[model samples]
Target: MRNLLPFRSAPAPTSKVAALAAVTAVVAVAAGIASAPVAAEHTDAHAVVRDGQNIRYAGLTVRIPAAGEGVQAAAQSTSGDISLTVTRSAEGKLVVKTDDHEHGDEDHGDEAHADEQAEAQAVTADSARPAAAKTCTDRAYALAGWKLPSFAWYYNPAGAPAAIAGTAASAISAGTNALSTACGQKRLGLVPSYAGQTSAAVQVGAAGNCIGNDGRNVIGWRAGSGRWLGMTCTYFKTINGKKTVTGTDTALNTQYKFFTTTANCNNAYDLQSVVLHERGHSLGLNHVSQSANASAVMTPALSTCSAGKRSLGLGDYQGLAALYGTR
Candidate 1:
C-alpha cells in the first residue's frame, strides 16, 4: 500500500499543454499459474502536483475477478502506484505495465496456450507510457512561465473603518516600496488603489480567515488584462480555524496564509523590504536558504525589516528577468 499525504490547501493550476502519446501496456504472469483460469483488471488515475513543487500519483482503484479459494491470482501493475520508481521517461511520458493471472487447468492445454498468448500480448501493450504524464522538466518549465506583478497598496475608508485604513495603507505602501528597491528599480513595481466599503478586507499577522481557507488578499490585475494576480500579507486569523501564519514551498492560491509582522504595519517591516520578499513569490520565485547573503530578499525566514539591501540581488534579478525577459 502506498502512503499518501493529505492535502492541506488548494491544488495549483496545472498547464493544459498537450503531452506525448501513450505507450503500450505490458503484462507478465508467473509461468506456474498457467494451469488455472486467470482473471485480471486495470485502471488509471491523475497525478497531483504539490505546493513544494513535487509530483504525486493519484491511486488507481483496480478490481479483479475472483477465480476460487487457493486458486487465486497474483496481480502486478505499474505507473499508477505513487512509488518513486514510476517516473516519466526522457521524452516526458508515463509508462504503465502489469503482470497478473491465476492458475490455469492443465486439462485444458489448448485453452491454456491461448491464455498465455493473450497475457503476453497484454504485457507488451502495457509497456508503453502515456504522453500526458507529468514530468519534472515540464514542471520546471511551467514554473518558469509564472509572472510576478508589481505590488500595490489600496485603501477605502468606506470599505474599512477609518481607524485601520491609514495604518493598512501605510504598511502596504512601505512594503511595496521596500520590495521594489530590493528587487531592482523596475523589477518590483507598485500599483495604487485602496480598500473601501466595497473593497476587499486586508489581513495582518494572523487575522481573518487567511490561514486555513482558500482565499487570497490582493485580487485583480495590475496590468488590467490577462491573468489577474492576487496578493496577501499574513496576519492573525483562523485558517480552517488553525493559528498558523505562513506557508512554504506552496503557491499563493486561495488557501494558505501570507504573513507579515506587526511592526510591518507600524512601519517596522520596511516597505521596500517586505514588498520585495512577497513580490518574489508573486513572480514565482521560491524562497532561498542562503544565510550568508544578508542582501538577498529571497532568503528564507524574515529576520528583520531592515533594507534587505532594498534591491533585487543578482539571483532575484536573474530569475525574474528570465521569466519576463528583463522588461
Candidate 2:
C-alpha cells in the first residue's frame, strides 16, 4: 500500500503544546481525480504559450496567460468568492492580485500550492527559502491527540476524471499507511473509508482564513493561490479537559502533479509529503515549535522539487509519541 507519491512552516499558535487542539488555519499559515488523459503532459506555462495553462496552490485557480505576454489573466478561487489575477509585472516576477471580497483569515501555512497545474506554472523564486534538512534524527511537535481509537477518512471522486480520482484514492491510502507505521501501536491510527464522494460542493472547506469545519476530512483538489500546500481544518472540543479532534477536512491542491512515482518528479508536486504533514495537523499536532525543526515534516517552510520530505524524520515520530503517549 506504499506509493512513492510526490509532493511546512510555522506560524502563531504553533508552540502551545497545551493548546493541543490548535486549529490548522492553513499549511502559509497553513485530491482526486479525472481520467481524461492526464492533460497532455502538464503544459509548461512558464513562458506563457499561445494557450493558457494552470496549477493548484492551496486549491486556488491561477490561469497563466499565453505567449509570455503581459496580459492580466483572471483565475477563480475554489471557494468562488475570490478571483485571482496573475500578471508578470517584472521580467521575472509573479504579481498576484485578488478580487476576493471575502478574504481568508490568518493561519498556519506551508509551501504554497502551485500557481498552475495544467497549462500554466508560475512560482515565485523569492518564495523559495532555505529549509531545514535533518540528519535523520528524532523530532517532536508541541502537542497531539486523536478522538477515536482509530481514524477513518473518505475521498470524493465524483467531479475529477477517472485517473485523477483513482490516484488520489491510492495515494491517500498510502499516506495513511505511513502514519500507522509512524504512530507505532498507538490507539490513534488513520483508517481509510470508502464512505463515498463528498456531498459538499468543495472537497475542502475553510472559514475566513481557517480550514472550515464540516466533518469531511477529504483528499481532493482545485485551482487557487500558491499559498498553502495542504490544510486540515478541524473541529475539536475539550473532552474531560483534553483536546479531541471531533472532525476534519483534510485537503490538497489537486492542480499540482501529486507525484506517485519518482519518474514524474520533474513536474508534479510531492503528494505524500504534503498529505502526511496535514495528517499530523488533523491529529492535534501543531507546527514543530515555530522556528525550531524545519527538518521535521511539520516544519513551516517547504521548497520546490524537494522530495526528501516524503519520509518522516525521527523527531517527527517523537512528536507523535508525545501526542499519543508511547505505543
Candidate 3:
C-alpha cells in the first residue's frame, strides 16, 4: 500500500490534475504491495534478509536492504523512495548526533540498517560565538522535507525513576508544547497535543534496530549505559519528492540520569530540554550547525544542567515558521 497514511494531510496540490495523479500513485503503490511476493522476513533486524524485503510500518511499505548488501539504515521503499534517520545524544558537551542511511546512495545502495553510535563532545555555549554577541543573529536551520500536520504522541512511564515518576510525563508534554508555540506569539501551525500514555514501548533493539512497526508514536525510558542519552527513530516515505513522516519513537536512556525540574537539576541532563530537542526533530527540523546555531534548540549539542533550551531561539522559530507557517 501507499506509505503515506490516509490520516495525514497531504500538502495542497496546485491543480486538480496533480491531485488526481497523487491519488493514482497511491493506488498503484497499494496494488503493487498486494500482488508482490512475500519475503522470508519483513523489517525484522534479527533475521537476515536476502534479495531485500518489503516491510510495512504503520501504513507505509518500506523496502529493507539485504544482509551484507549494506544494512537497514540504507533501505528504501518499493518505488525506491524512503529513508530513515537515527538520532542519539552522547556524554560531555551534550551532542545530539545523527546518522542518515538513505535507500539510493550508491555507496550503500538502499541498504537499510540502524546505527546507535553516540558521538561525545563538550559543547559549551560560547564555543563559536563571542561571549557577548547575541545568539540569534545567525538564523540558521535545515528542514528534513517532512512536516506533520499535527503531532499525536503517547508516553510510556514504565522505566521512570521514583523521584520524577509522575512529573516526567508532564515534562514530556511541555516539551511538545514548546514547539507548537515556538513561533513568536502564535502556534507553529503543526500543533502537538498529548495523546495520553501508552504501555507500548519504543521498539529499538540493543543494537539499534529501530523498526517503528508498533504504529503508535511513543516516548519512554530504556535502561542502558552508553554515550547515548536519548534516541529518536523517525520513519517517512517520499511522495512527489516530498517526505511524509508516518511516525516517530523517542527513548530516553535512564542509565545516563536525568532531572525533571531545574530546581533539582545538577550535573544530569534536563529532561524537558532533551525532549525539546527531540520534539524539534519530530516537527521536521534537522540539526543546525553547532558552530553557527549553537543557541538554537535544534542545535546538535546541549550542555548538561542547561535549561536555556527550554525556550526556542530565533533560528528555531524561523525554521518552524518556514515549514508550517505561524498560526
Q: Against the unseen true structure, what C-alpha lDDT does each candidate score?
A: 0.28, 0.41, 0.50
Please write out the lDDT profile of model 2 over residues 1-327, one tens digit for every residue: 101111101111111122212232111100111111111111122221111243222333333322222111122222111222233322333323232111123112232111122211121221222244342443444342334334666676554434445576676666655665442334333343546666564334332123244555565654433445564545454455554555566556555455655565655555676677677666644444223444566554454555656655555555555455553
- Which of the predicted structures, 2 or 3, would earn the higher TM-score when compared with the native? 3
Q: Give the better candidate number (1 or 2) by TM-score.
A: 2
Per-residue error (Å), model 1, residue 83? 24
Local distance difference test, candidate 2: 0.41
Instruction: Name model 1 segments beyond 4 Å from true.
Output: 1-145, 148-171, 177-198, 202-268
Q: What lDDT does candidate 3 reach at residue 149?
A: 55
Q: How many residue pairs clash in each candidate?
A: 71, 66, 17
The predicted structure with the larger lDDT, 1 or 3, is 3
Q: How does each model score on TM-score?
A: 0.34, 0.51, 0.63
Compute the lDDT for candidate 3: 0.50
Better of 1 and 3 by TM-score: 3
